[model samples]
Target: MSKKKNKVRPLPQTVGINVPGVETHAHLDMEDFKEDLPEVMARAKECGIAKIGNVFLGPQAYETNRSLFDAYPEVFFLLGVHPNDADQYTDADTQAMRNAFKSDSRLKALGEIGLDFYWDRVPADVQEKVFRTQLELADELDVPVVIHSRDAHEKTLEVLEDYGWSGKPLLWHCFGSDVATAKRILDNGWYLSIPGPVTYKKNEEAQEAVKFIPAERMVFETDCPFLTPEPWRGKRNEPAYVAFTAAKVAELKGMDVNELWAICAKNAYDFFGL
Candidate 1:
């Protein structure tokens, strides 16, 4: 008789808490979960994650993972060229993004795009050009935009203002800016997607931002497999852990966790039309 082989499955590192909400930003298509993606999605659902916006960083990423929208009905996508990869963006890439947006109803927005001075991989001039190009694409398509600004908040807002972004829907994803910046974002009528950083004790700015931003204009995200919240910091993040961010923000706002979740979920739905 041939000996039988036993296969052992790995346990999910982060268990999701049962708190229904929407994770406004994540990258489920990334290679980080190549082996355990099914389990990750299941855990997110079990944790009451009703919907997720899976952002694609570039044309290649979008082309590779475009099937995820049909595979998971709860998962929508945001296609754009990230500022870090701005140098590599081409006319062909822009056309591909346009085609994808046109063909897929699940393509909710154009984003994870903006300025990132911290990396400095692409020249600031090139980043701005790519940023403006994508913004124009979003404007032409009449879709919302998700922005990623790091160490370039002033420039980011300047570009948005220059583009006459007053009437469009804009989301500042993973907002870690100061109170004044938050107020400015609010003044521009842009939504803010809070992330796991709010759960950290040292993230006073995030906490303060949450306090000032009204409930209607606020949303939550995981930005996983990154920015794992407190108690799971330094570990891989996933959609399920977005609850921690909600709980922390709720506490800061002196509201019940579920109430905050519902508000943010509705805000996400309204903003992304999910």
Candidate 2:
């Protein structure tokens, strides 16, 4: 068998049209971008990304690493305790998140929160408790919700419905599920944030779901520092890579990349209330 050498793929800036776009989710605060974050931000800007939502795992991360993106005015914030960290949620953390939201105008949504049966770091009951608590907090704050369900979609949907989140400002992040799942999300009046994996040929379900999802209800996210889109797969993902995801979605929907890019950006801006 021959060894498969790395291919020299085109940079993200070369993948999509130079039209304004938005990266609905990112984690630029992670150690991956610590060394060359400035260069990454520059490339994202050059690739025509207008705004980027930087998600903080919890109140502490928001307080500690939120400032890292202050210099980039186009970056917004999303804060929540992840399901994997269910045991870590406390009343104090809740208070801290409340305080942060009250003080920071950049915090746009309560996000990356929900079920994650894929990882057994936390018990199901504990994860449910934490998820419900954050959902309650989101309602109290009247903020939008960004979900992070993994292999627990049915449970996540049931919980959202139970919380009366239908027709509310909600986003299903990294939605690489099937048409039925996409329909379920849309039926609940929630937005679907298509991630980089949708560009992969193996992710045919998501690709087909994209065709079924209305452009008005669709948005693009790199989920960066993760889910690096092809042409750049196996590389560290950054906000710039969102352009490639948006480009691929446009191609799948038979729309112009520039137009689709702008539409998704607009949808994201409206969803986040930017």
Candidate 3:
């Protein structure tokens, strides 16, 4: 008697309109793409990404954002020193960010900004100073802000509250924090941007947190070239794979993927004013 063989099949490829999406945050100038940005961006365009929100860290990246804007119309710019690079912000750097934010309507938000105690590359005080200053700058410009919070949620919230973010649009990017934290952020009426990692197995925290975010206040992102979802984890992420992230959100929210797509797309469009 011959034994029957079992066949394994690959996951179905994602298909749908690559409607223009606004990546809430990504570091395209991270030196990881120093050699092949053209190919990277080509794939991004092919994937239906209409715009990329690139965050600049210091003086060099600050300038790079301006240059990139002139070079690639599809790429949008945000100016702020990242938490890890907090020490790099000088009076000149802050002035540069302010000037860029003031002069260009294209500069949408002050971002990639917030607390990150995980690496502790800079002193907590320095991070707080830079974060607060940028927040003030964003407030002055009447522009929304994108925040990068990790391990220092309490302090981050405290600072934002102290700064009085009562009527501003705040984006919490790549949100993988706890439900309680999500509730706090939501209570403040800020938007939580979900990324691909929500699809990962055992990512209960992210899944739980996403449940409380209403569709209108939630946005989708790939944070591309990083945080690629399951079945594609460990590989470089791209804009096209954001469908996987949206699919995961749909599953978590108990809604149809199409509905989730529409809701997320609207939220993104409004958030970026695109």
Give the candidate number with the greatest TM-score: 2
lDDT of candidate model 1 versus the reference: 0.87
lDDT of 1 by residue, 1-274 (tens): 9888855423323333455578999998888988888888988887778898899888788888767556688988888888999999899988998989999898899998999999889999999999999999998899999999999999999999989997579999999878999999999999999999898898898788789999889999999999998767788998888877877888899988778788888998899887
Evaluated at residue 217, the lDDT of candidate 2 is: 96
Candidates sorted by lDDT, best first: 2, 1, 3
Which TM-score value belongs to model 3?
Answer: 0.88
TM-score of each: 0.92, 0.97, 0.88
lDDT, model 2:
0.91
Local lDDT at 16 for model 2:
54
Cα lDDT computed for each candidate against the true fold: 0.87, 0.91, 0.78
Candidate 1: segments with Cα more than 4 A from true spot: 1-19
10 residues in a row with least lDDT, candidate 3: 9-18
Question: What digit string (tens of lDDT, one per residue) describes model 2 on residues 1-274?
Answer: 9999978788877875677778989999999999999999899899998889999998888888987987999999999999999898999988998888888899899988999999889999999999999999999999999999999999999999998999999999999999999999999999999999998989888899999999999888988889988888998889888888888898899999999988888998898888
User: Which digits, one per residue and each the tens of the lDDT, describe model 3 over residues 59-168?
Assistant: 57777545654778887777777899888777887777777777777777778799999998999999999899888878777888888988999999999988999557
Considering lDDT, which of the candidate structures 1 and 3 is the better prediction for this target?
1
Ranking by TM-score: 2, 1, 3
Q: List the residue pairs that clash in candidate 1.
A: none
